[model samples]
Target: CSASSGCGTGILANYFDHYTVFNKPVQSGIAVGDFVTLEISSSELFSRAFMLYIFPILALFMGSYMGMRLFPATELWQISFGIFGFISALLLTKYFVK
Candidate 1:
């Protein structure tokens, strides 16, 4: 793995040439430009994927449902609430999920 940024005595790794994996624990004697094997559990991966993909959708649906129950006369309000819910979910996930 190649070092992306140096933090204190540790280095952040750039994985798959796209994503940066931070706060990784490194073993002694491993230095910059060295190849390393990273292992992630299936359950952990699934949970991360679910949080990234499913949570926002569920929030949007719930928001739309709330909008329908609160304002049954207007389709515009329902759509607006759904969009608001979607955006709120995205922000929550980005800041709070990790």
Candidate 2:
């Protein structure tokens, strides 16, 4: 092969070698619209699967803060605070990393 032809072939070979890594797939999961539509479409769904998924998180914070104030010296109080702190950090990382 000519000098230019050899270089062109080398570049093509490099591209093919890395194609699997370089062509990684999209990482999208469930969309927010589906959540919204589910809640809108069925009252049972809003109470059952949707609320079940959502409420533990809401309860975690609500119960944690109230427990923090109510039982300041308890070991369980410390655990609640730790969980609250951990969730906050995870949420912050997710928000800022994007």
Candidate 3:
């Protein structure tokens, strides 16, 4: 177990002979080099995937649509709004994922 990025607890382990690092809580009595089991629910995985991938795209499209309606003469405004929306969604996703 060791400190990961963002100062969270993490574990470095070997899986399928490849070294991988996971940011997860460690139980008491567990030590480095000890074997442990990790499990993730399908629903949780799906939710995370959707938030990380789909949500930002949806936000960008919505923003583009709104910008087009509000600024019909300016393509620049539409693209700016879409980029802003994508960035906002990423920030929100980061906050919620934790």
Candidate 4:
């Protein structure tokens, strides 16, 4: 066994040390999944939602489109990007959310 038993606990612990603040916590409430909605002119809320939720989706779509670029599209790029993004987001959510 490596020093930490190959458990990745050191990396995991470091991840929480850095990211645990970005996610809010809720226990047994309707507000658990609720993100504060933005008023029309509120750029900060919009930016937060885009950064946390929408931008990644859009980027993946763009990645696939850019790969095709008016040619017949292939599944290779989309699949690879999707798998990578899923793994990344899983780690991020685990790290940031208690």
Best of the candidates, TM-score: 1
Candidate 4 versus the native: TM-score?
Answer: 0.36
What residue pairs are clashing in model 1?
none
| TM, every model | 0.74, 0.32, 0.68, 0.36
- C-alpha lDDT score of every prediction, in listed order: 0.80, 0.56, 0.85, 0.57
Provide the global lDDT of candidate 3 against the true structure.
Answer: 0.85
Error of 1 at 42 (Å): 1.7
Better of 2 and 4 by TM-score: 4
What are the per-residue Cα lDDT tens digits for candidate 2 across 1-98? 24535696556565554332233343468563443221235776565543444545665676677777878888698567657755765565455432
Give the per-residue lDDT digits (tens) of candidate 3, residues 1-98: 34444342232222233455788889899998899999989999999989988999999999899889999999998999999999999999999985
Candidate scoring better on TM-score of 1 and 3? 1
Leading candidate by lDDT: 3
Residue pair clashes in candidate 3? none
Lowest summed lDDT over 10 consecutive residues: which window, candidate 2?
32-41
Ranking of predictions according to TM-score = 1, 3, 4, 2
lDDT for 4 in candidate 3 is: 40
Every model's Cα RMSD, please?
A: 8.8, 18.4, 9.1, 13.1
lDDT-better candidate, 2 vs 3: 3
Error of 2 at 72 (Å): 3.8
lDDT of 1 at 91: 94
lDDT agreement of model 4 with the native: 0.57
Runs in model 3 lying further than 4 Å from the true structure:
1-31
For 1-98, candidate 4 gives per-residue lDDT tens digits of 14554576555555554443444444455465676542346786566555656656765666556545544467776666665665565556456534
Writing each residue's lDDT as its tens digit, candidate 1 over 1-98 gives 33336542134223324556678779999999999888889999888777778989998998898899899999887888898999998998888767
